[model samples]
Target: MTRVFSERSSTRATRRPELEAAVKLAGEIRSSDVAVTLVVHEHKWLGRGTELAMLTEELKTSDVGLEFLTGELKGSHGPSGIVFTVLAAMSGMEREYLRDQEVSLRDIATGAKKGQHSSPATVMRMLREHDEQAATAASA
Candidate 1:
């Protein structure tokens, strides 16, 4: 049992760096407004956790358009069985936005779209705007 457990634990630990890298990469990609598929392909070995983390962090700041795609990564598929619940908090805002008005998900999606050449501040501002909208709506 001890040997089995250690082996399993070791496997989990080995994937951590990959997951971290993927998360960081996803965050970078989200900020850029570049399609994640393009970004994922450009960088080989972007582990699921890292990508998920990046998306989660990015969504935390703005309205992440591809929630379904992000949801796909939340299950046991990722390395080390890491889940993507970190993004759930964003869903509430997403849901509220969808419920309140005739807003198109496409528009919100487009609103957060960043050009491949956009600056980090631009991405940060977009995320901030999404958060501000959500906060204001919640208060009202």
Candidate 2:
């Protein structure tokens, strides 16, 4: 029944629909003398931990009650808020690792390292880039 609304005036792109539905449902309940308890998933903001909590405080006790918590921190997500922080971090790290792998390929193409794996793809890319650099230098 406690009207627990967040400081945030708007919802994130992914959460907007659910939050809007809650508000709409609350409006209907408010028109009546009935009280309802609505359970919603808890969500947190990235780098701002729970900065944009949902409209729990906004619910009127006389009309409805709203609170949500999962068995684990179902709501604790990363910057996207949909992906858990650890997963998000790991995904980025994976991409970086892939890119780092390409560095060795580049080394092989430039004769700085031995091509222990696929030789053609990396060398092709290197040749293209080398030609581009040469053309730019010629124009300069």
Candidate 3:
């Protein structure tokens, strides 16, 4: 991946090997003086809540920063921000859409358990169910 940086800031892709190394080093240092912000292409990679949570915790403890959208910092950071934002947003949205696929897969598994045909087209119902369950669990 490209190492994009300016006088006061720097960024790396979510899946970059350099970032992995940096995180490892940061873990060893455990110094509050070291600050790093990891900016995610919010539209591309933030869909995995568990992954995000774990990474966030690791980075937070090591003084690393996580940014969800680089496009928002365009014009202010680098020449690529404006163009990257559109691509990043699209990527993030695409991942978000896969959660729908997860709902379908869950339905399919449920149907198999019940000896019934599964229909994955029920987007509205699945979203509502997921939202309500998430809210209930959150409150609990």
Candidate 4:
């Protein structure tokens, strides 16, 4: 079993009942450790923004360790940093999407030509288009 430590009296602990209870248990047992097994079921657990951010923080901080209780499970051990990295990238993409939406609204208001869409998938597309434009300009 893996053990995770919780900082008692933390603001987050107060906010989250699970964390608060864990903290209380740790205090009662004279050990600041809690064991947790992470199971992702059909991507539902990761869909929530607040939950995702909290879980990421929990994984990042303390002495939290990941363990698979199921014998049939075949995957990499422990929590991977890739999860957080992907989350961060997704967050960036979301920000970009919002920015693109704002730009589109502004363009509409100003009656400017609507250009290419600024989306996560369009990142590479935009780069390719920019490169092509640069190449054409250079040729000219």
Candidate 5:
């Protein structure tokens, strides 16, 4: 929960009603310094990365601790710094996948030139293995 919801409040950046309620609640009860856990079924509920980063920082400023589980990212996380790190890495991750795709195309093209498939299977296998490893790490 990240903000107090009001029907008249037009500035709620996060679309999740529960988050807004939680934020409101946390602010009210923050004298005891309790942490809030926010569960999100969709990453979009957090809005853009910048929005999320700012929300976390706001929580910290108000002495409200925040922990979150997001289905899109599929993990439980706390700490505002981690949000910035994760957002920064997202573009690099996308770039890695895009480069892999290009490599696959080049690999097959090179094989075709020689009348063979130059084993693009290796690239695909590596990608699958990477996926498996990531799943394992996430589950752990």
Candidate 6:
């Protein structure tokens, strides 16, 4: 009963219209009770306007919802130096929460490396601990 969403920007054209369109689409999807996320890539050789137009058209009637993930490889760079960027959007609040927790866990793990000792294993352990805490907090 939850929704998650995300976006990815292409480097081909970082124009305002395209960015706006993407943001608008994201907002619309998120407002509809879908959790939203975004990722942006840089592609300077492509026309932002054209790309935006194409994306706008493509996403006009999407119903399953979107979860945008950036940096996913779609294809190789073409002769024109054009690169294919991938955008993945998922729908669901539970998914969103889990995603957020994973992100936080990663951050904690990374930060812990600076001085404290923490590994992915430790992070997972902490996540479980926090989950229990959360459940306790909710019950109270």
User: Which TM-score value belongs to model 4?
Assistant: 0.36
Regions of candidate 1 where Cα sits further than 4 Å from its true position: 1-15, 37-59, 62-140
Whose lDDT is higher: candidate 3's or candidate 5's?
5
- Every model's TM-score: 0.24, 0.30, 0.32, 0.36, 0.39, 0.22
lDDT of 4 by residue, 56-137 (tens): 5555454333333333222333445454544435434534554566755444323243342232234435556889999999
Model 3 C-alpha lDDT per residue in residues 27-116, reported as the tens digit of each score = 555464544444444322332222333444465556544455543322222213443333333333323554454535443322222322
Among the numbered candidates, top lDDT falls to 5
How close to the true structure is residue 3 of candidate 3, measured as C-alpha lDDT? 40
Instruction: Tell me, by TM-score, which candidate is best.
Output: 5
Candidate 1 clashing pairs?
Answer: 22-50, 22-51, 23-50, 23-51, 33-114
Regions of candidate 5 where Cα sits further than 4 Å from its true position? 1-18, 62-72, 87-140
* lDDT tens digits by residue: candidate 5, 8-69: 32222335565666666766666566665444443434433334445555565566543434
Off by over 4 Å in 3: 1-19, 25-32, 43-47, 70-140
Question: Which candidate, 1 or 4, would have the higher lDDT against the true structure?
Answer: 4
State candidate 1's TM-score: 0.24
- What ordering of candidates by lDDT runs from best to worst? 5, 4, 3, 2, 6, 1
Query: For candidate 1, lDDT tens digit of each residue in 1-140?
Result: 00111112221122445444444555576577754421121111222222333544454454223222222232222211122242333333443444355555554343332222122223335568989999999999
Flag the better candidate by lDDT, 1 or 3.
3
| Tens digits of lDDT, candidate 6, 75-109 | 33321221222221111222244346564434332
Q: Which stretches of candidate 2 lie over 4 Å from their true place?
A: 1-15, 43-54, 61-63, 69-140
lDDT for residue 103 in candidate 3, whole number 0-100: 39
Judged by lDDT against the true structure, how good is candidate 3? 0.40
Position 51, candidate 2: lDDT: 18
